[model samples]
Target: KIKNWLSAPDSSRNMNEAYGKLQDGTCSWFFEGEQFSTWKEEPSFLWVKGKGKFLLVSLSSIIHNVDLAKQDSSLSMAYFFFDGRDSQTELQLHHKLIRSLIWQLSYREDHKVPLPLVNLYKKYGHQQPLDRVLRDRSFRWIALQIEELKKCASKNEIQKKLGKLPRGLDETYQRILKGIDRDYWDDTKIFLQFLAFSKRPLKVDELAEVITVDLGSEEGPAFIEDKQYQDPRIVLTRCSSLFLLLYLLNKTSGIIKLSHFSVKEYLLSPMLTKELFMSDAAFTNWVQLWNIDLNIWDQKRSRDKTDVMKMASALYYASLAGIKPTVELLLTNKAEVNAQGGWWGNALQAASAECHRDIVELLLVNKADVNAQGGDYGNALQAASFHGHRDIVELLLQNKAEVNAQGGYHGNALQAASARGYKYNVELLLINEAAVNAEGGYHGNALQAASAEGHRDIVELLLQNKAEVNAQGGEYGNALQAASFHGHRDIVELLLQNKAEVNAQGGEYQNALQAASAGGHRNIVELLLQNKAEVNAQGGYYGNALQAASTGGHRDIVELLLQNKAEVNAQGGYYGNALKAASHWGHRDIVELLLQNKADVNAQGGEYGNALQAASFHGHRDIVELLLVNKAEVNAQGGEYGNALQAASAEGHMDIMELLQEKDAINEDHKEEFSTE
Candidate 1:
């Protein structure tokens, strides 16, 4: 049936659709090329020809028949396909393969399923439906099997049973390792070491670039530009039979990862490292390789070459990795103790950021620069504070690492800790006399960062420490505006209680009331209003609280602002006035409310000229008609498309244009407006 369907002229066999069907049990056959001939020996399995491929089916009947042939056998057969396109699918396939083996082992010709196998089935089977299990891509099946194995009478019995299993990942990996020639063994070992130990996944090109560079050369590291850019494939070729066991090809990104995370776990095992002749020195070398400068000469002539070279060393990576032995080995070999390189800038900073207390202490003991000012967090103090590594922060402080160093992502240690809501770290910094109102980071100051993140305790602490509540600089304007925008009612209340100026205007949303209205925080808007917030204040992103509320389609907030006596025809925001904002967003109800509240339908300003022009431009014919019915000047010329009729015509809204034309809205001036273009 499948073959005939495939051969049909109208056959629409999408690979993804077929795969989905097979997974859902709606399809039992999978298409393959002529290569499927190898499985023809299996009597239970059938292959049928398709247009240019064959459909292979191994259903329940085939499985039952196969079990009958091996009713009394102790050994089970399992087959796995590694070409799965995704991790979830791959894991599900693994479960299916394992289940099949267990199913075969459970069968007996003379009796019911064996007690152990039956118990195993009862424990793991039918608990989670197959569809739900696959959807979640759970590891429950694997965990159940491991638990069953633990119930074996003895370790020897468990080993004996496991010995009968098919060649698994570990065995396959060992086999590949054994097959590699001695000539390429060292290079392969080093390459695998990098994959096994590196903190982040190395890109294929990056791995290739690093491996081809000679790190030991005196003329600094030389980048072999002519080397194969597609080095992952080359590495696989060099490892030969072992490639599949070691690496998993991510088809979407073309980046190769370890076949499974377990592969790295196996490679990192002490016994495997010993067998492969890998040592701390080799690990240090791998770290050194990551830092080698390809453009060494160009960098040397630059202003800060020493700092750059130091930044690109093994000590920084080893410190980042938190590998004490490798770090000690590198330090012993006279690796730059305070080498500045990588993202964190220096070894101390890297160690500090990752909360590697031991390494941080080691670098400090080696007389590493305590106040280095370069990396993402600026110095060790800020790095530790940013990551909430209290012990490391204390250590850096004890070593007199400058607490007020101004640079990196959050500007200073105090702001970094406060921004991340690290109460203890913030207190420690404050105790050490760090500036509470330091102004120069991403969030302007600690108070604003704390307020923006909705950290009430941090905000209170900063306020208590005399931090400026109205410090206007960061992304969100002021503490009150930031808190209001993010819907942090308690924080907003606290700021207000701390004397945050209710009418202060400056940031992205201009004022607290507008920010609150824009974010749809009705309660905050109400709170700001109660605090005597200026409802008609204009400036900032959305102009006024009513306009901001209207732009966001917050009908209740808009109504509240209107009740507070907000200007109905206020003109400043991106959408001109509240009426235009409501019309542009197609909020007919809000438009009705605004129009009933005496909003000017012909108010001309902002991105769209008037409410009619905004409504017509956006293809909101009902809104355009409503505006016109409400006495909007249709012939009014302004905004991007000149007038309402021209705006409708420009957007190809013929129905709206016809309505406008029927009203005689398009005048000679409107015609001239389009003629010039």
Candidate 2:
């Protein structure tokens, strides 16, 4: 279920359709040619350049040979052949290709699906039906999951097989239609009509349910549930070769689509059009029966004509749904295609964000602004790149989108792409002259964003593009500190290799060493120490690495810092010193270790002047006793509460107050004896 729901259905039928007609040894010329030999020998993409209808047929032979050769070996192979005859299928051609490849490569000896795919399924599967799970957003999400896969060679070249004249196609389709049982004529016609004009592919269950809707009933259109087929699979038998079942993994019934555009053309022919119920009128009836508004899917359309935002929302939503006709209708009615107020700002950004490549092109052609800045991503390019929509990103770039236009949560397209780990988008943006080190956003710059997000490949790419590794300004300051704070040890090493300054200070944790210590990442701490990070560097909330570690109760880290000769009495942060931080935080073990390392018992400099006062104010009696035993002044003056006695009294710690009083009394008696002497 996980694999099937998450991956594209296998393209075996498409491959078989191409392979079945080939003569066994016909493609030997290409295999023996230099192009094939070079591609096989090197680990690079093979572009079989040519200009003819026979090119695809020959390529199919090569794919089959490669598949057979790679089987049962360490090498794995996946292939997709694009057919552009059907405009509807072509809308999702890239999706089908990517999904098919993902499914093919996911197979393993243990038969376990990859964790990322499983997680994607868990997130989007139960929230919607299986047919609805492969929408634009989720498709982009899964594509980004394995964008690092080997490059695939593709062509928009038409195949001669599907380009046959209408006469031959009409006869082949007509015979299949005539062979259907007379009893199944009405249902079969409705099925064929649905496939011929549906917005997207329909699942068997959905089509079966749609067939039960009585649009011409005396009572307004309603689903006659009793009219539904007992078994949805029966629809396949009714249509035969005219339709194809795209079965997903682990499922019996699957999506139903036309076998070819020729079948659609035959169905919509002058002679069969009326019989198959294929017409704009039939689609209108469907729209009415399904309760869908033709102009917009949104129910919150503006009641008042003057409300521009609400009026513009219709166009935005129409674009978002990838309903080209609705978008056209709204645009024809003077809808604001460049209106800037929605989750995605405008029609162009919404379309771009959702991977609606055609709609994006439509809007751009309709004069939609390419660089109008607003909303979550600021502009279309950033939104497209952030969501891993490479086609849309390229479209936006080609339309003159400012690659360095900064304003969104991610600041610019490069940072947005980098943060999301969309390396392909990042590469595309870099190639288009995006400022790799351009600053201003949540993660400061592209390198910091990639590093903070643990996208090593993106980090490497940014570095190769000359990204500043030690550049500061985000939540984690620089790339190295971000990686360290996030416990990304490998990224930390990479940043170091790029000459990231180990002691560069400026974020919430000041330096990588302090950030690592505060995060309790011992391995990163060791790495930083090896790179000569200043152990006693002071400037963040916790003063130094030792204080930060102590405050976090990271005893192991504190011990490591002490062994590294960290100043036990280093003072300059909130809790004054390491002992004061540990005592106030109730880390008795760390306090003991700090004291043993000779941390000044009476060091005064932070919110709590001394360790005793800090422990007393917090009512950590065990820590208080430990501090007292270490000879911390019982009446130490100066701190938030003035002294240990007053600090304990203010917090209403009776046991601590009494202990402090007794210690004070002992000191007083000693003072009197000394005065008498």
Candidate 3:
């Protein structure tokens, strides 16, 4: 691919055409310019250096020992002339190197030279004398032309050449402003600013959703009509030149990015941004334009109103972007410091969540609400804790933010920090007197949260800090259950050593043993069993430990449980019995093992009527045959699809149906003879 690109005609074209294609959004802006000599015979290592607008390609070793003696004289003279006269920047050094190679290729006639060089020699050898070319004024003029081509190739220079150079992102954006119809200018400008300043690339649908939100209304942004959610290309049509869709290898998934990295640089440039707010009037106009109104409106009246206020203001975007100056400018213009809307809820939360310490400090100084609630993380502290922003957490804490505030994904700041395994932050929260037993979040409390994530150190810390080890609340019921379910044997052992009740029931999986069995954690299951966990103790998603292991097709666990005297025909839980559960999932080996252990083949319970029906329904012919040979009642009726024959027939299994019918007929013959006797 590199060789084909280097040899292509496009490589020889001037930068003007290349930059034109890039700006017009007709070509990708990833052009490569060779910076190192390719004429060397040794293995060449290509090094890529990204300069202002173009990628400079160079070689690690410019010349092999064989080529050096032949090509050294001419190449050295060119380099000496360019190097001694001027102190060149890296880009300029690359330019000089490329120009010297062009000169060498233009005049050299040696057949031993590389093919690309040979081709160039064939084209330009007759035009100039090889040795005297550097001394000739006309050859110097050709050098000047190549320099001009380099300038044209630069994205920045291309913009300047086309008379489209804006002082910064705002100026370039103003061009987009001019092109948009006045009706869309307000909403469109807001959307463009988000595209320019967001921390991460926005999906096409996300952009659409944000723009249509009326930030001015207090009741929250109204959902735009479905018709307004048009294709992404349509949304970006007027300013298509400024954006490009970066398609993934799948071609279906893509995110929007600026056409060139320079575009982002221009937007972020301090000089250009300063020009945007040179006057109070200009600043106020920008503020008003960017401000989202948070006033509530009558639903009936709002439906007819096309120009709803935006949900996020300029302050929100500035905070999200970490543009300190823009944030200061918005604040000075009285952009609401406590505005409660948008994805982050407010500017302070956005800054805190993003870990922009300077911005967070600035917002705090501006008296932004440190305890403001309502967003994904519920408040700034929780957001900071969730993302492990220790500095931000410290700052918020110093500002008298509530230490025990209850809200957000993890319920509170401590739980959030603990869940994510932020040990230092968890320590900080604990030092600040964060509630040790705070409940009500994703993981019921800090201990369970730590246990669920397998953070042994955090679990130890919580336990040492007097956390309720056997505290019965959370997604997994308690810390021990949470650890066992996730196969965290070490944490489970720790919880157990801390005196967590081994038989403690109440979670998606009833107890520690059942949870371990369901998760296929044989070691944890064994440990729980060793610790005297009730093997037949029922009550969870699966009723018993043996059934749980059977449901998960853990044949070893099943055999181990049976060896420990687990009831083979025990009933209860999702599949009703161990044999039924094993048969349902078509684990032939487990089914045979259970049958050998004298599991009642005619055990009539569970989602399927019996073990025979469970096997037949799932098309496990061998298990069905095994069960039939063991005298499982062929006509046993009871369960979801009626009987074994009906179950097989319902699932379109003809062979199982034939076997069941043959067995039923034989049973009928036996019954008839007994009745006659």
Candidate 4:
């Protein structure tokens, strides 16, 4: 089945089939003696020797190794493919498009390189076209330009012969140089260069002498310090770190030759990246015949104590060293693959928790628990979801990791994903059929979690996927209250639009309106009001919406509630009137708004004494004056405010006393002294 991309005229885009159909059909520069044929397009792309079905493409000298000599100059990038367009543009844009291709293949640990875009024709721009049509089909030109730049020959000298540069080079190479100058993570070229030297011996031989001739070693640091030593290779060598490795290789030829030999035998070995230096399995096997303990998984431990901590540490160090340690090494005789540890986790737990899909795979292959929960991570899958490790989550799900296992931070992976707004992991879990409404630990269900965190997109996704909008609240995850509290106007709009219970209340906080009022979110209060959220629905520690808003000192919220007909003198909470409550906290705006809304001047709050006294006690002189101007009682005894004089004296408000004097208020009738300091 030939794809459309294979029919494209762009050589870089249609390389595979086009090159495959070539008369010679030989890329001696790459797979010297390889042949290609066909097989049934089933479920795999496993290329076999002498089979015309499987074919590979070389991505050509990705980096210039003329400078970085310490590290073996890795030349040549390779991958397999079935499409012809991948071959077409691939040929033309092969050199310059290296940066774009590397990014398209984000080679994180577990999700191995997409060798198909290189080798497999599966997702090649074979059929459905995308917006990005790669232009700078001149990676080789960029390489040339970089070489010319290294010469430091002045512009006229440099531009003496070569024609105009490609547009992409003009715009991008300078930028890439700027980044390399700043030490960014653009090492694919360097990495590919390293791969090149390590694989092809002839290529290695061609570059070795030029790169390894370190004249700087003789003059030490000052040798290359000469104005004559100003080579662009010097800069690239310093940046790419090839010079150091080459220097080391030259300094210690024995180690280099041995490691190089090992590379020849196992160029693609994951073990090489790790400390598991089994030079060769055959060689090691022969030595082991002598009863050698080739156990790389050695660690001191208590007999019954599985050192998950130590195992994690080893795995961590291995990854940093580009090592791929397996569960076989992790779970020796009785290392206990499922052993639990402290807060962090057990073996399976830690892998899942850290979203270390590779480690998790090794453990699961060796029988690590997937559903088992009792560590920092709720479960293996849950841990992956928490960290937004989508690939790891997919791996776990493929291996039958549970979708709704609970008992971690928010309970399950779904809720965890929702809490973090991990769109990819959330989608992965959902695609794997994660329960949307299933409660996770104490955080209710996925809907509640996404709503609480104001993750509108996730909430909309959940709602679209049919999560019950009113799935009863959890211990602390009250979806409606949470939306109201954070003033998440859009989330509130979404929930209400989706028929979420406006007056819903039954968790740590009660009712949407009260929560909104307490949170001082005027817009959310308005949305709830629009949705018919009860003006008096009460629950949380603060009681009704009026009291909640008044106590919260939310002047705007108070006015909106009043405009929505919230009772001003409504006696609620330990403090009675909203006016007295706001006044007690010196919230002058809320106090004045309440007064303007016709709140009673003498509305004696059970704990607040009266508006004037409450204002005086909190040293809200502005509030005291507003109340007095509104004809509030001058003296109100008992409760937190004590008496008017006592409250004013406590706050040291001489102006309040003078205001009382100006009002011809009698201090002889009532008197009380109080001291806090």
Q: State every prediction's TM-score relative to the real structure.
A: 0.67, 0.55, 0.62, 0.49
For model 3, residues 594-650, the per-residue Cα lDDT tens digits are: 999999999988888798888887888888999989888888878997677767866
Ranking by lDDT: 2, 1, 3, 4
Better of 1 and 3 by lDDT: 1
Stretches of candidate 3 exceeding 4 Å from the true structure: 1-290, 294-310, 662-677
Model 4 RMSD in Å is 22.3
Q: How many residue pairs clash in each candidate?
A: 3, 0, 13, 55
Which is the leading candidate under lDDT?
A: 2
Alpha carbon lDDT of each predicted model: 0.69, 0.73, 0.68, 0.54
RMSD of every prediction = 19.0, 21.4, 20.4, 22.3
> Residue 567: error of model 4 in Å?
0.4
> Of models 1 and 2, which has the larger lDDT?
2
Best-performing candidate as measured by TM-score? 1
Candidate 4 residue-pair clash tally: 55
| lDDT by residue for model 2 (1-677), tens | 86556546445434433553576456755654436644644648777765223666777666654642122335567776654322355325677677778876765534577788788878886765666453324333233223312222333222332353223444555655777898988888777777777655666766776576676767555445567677877778777743464643236656667755556666778897667774876655544433422232222423322121132365775676688887786688676678766667888988898799989988989999899988778889988988788989988889999999988778899998998788999999999999998998878999998887678889988899999888989767888888887668889999898899999989878899998887777889999999999999999777799998997678889999999999998878766788887787677888889888888888887776788887787778888888788888777678776777767766677788777777762334234421211
lDDT per residue, candidate 4, 214-311, as tens digits? Answer: 22344321111122222323423323331122322232221111122222233334533232233343222221221112131132323222121122
Off by over 4 Å in 4: 1-330, 475-478, 604-613, 629-635, 640-677
Global CA lDDT computed for model 4: 0.54
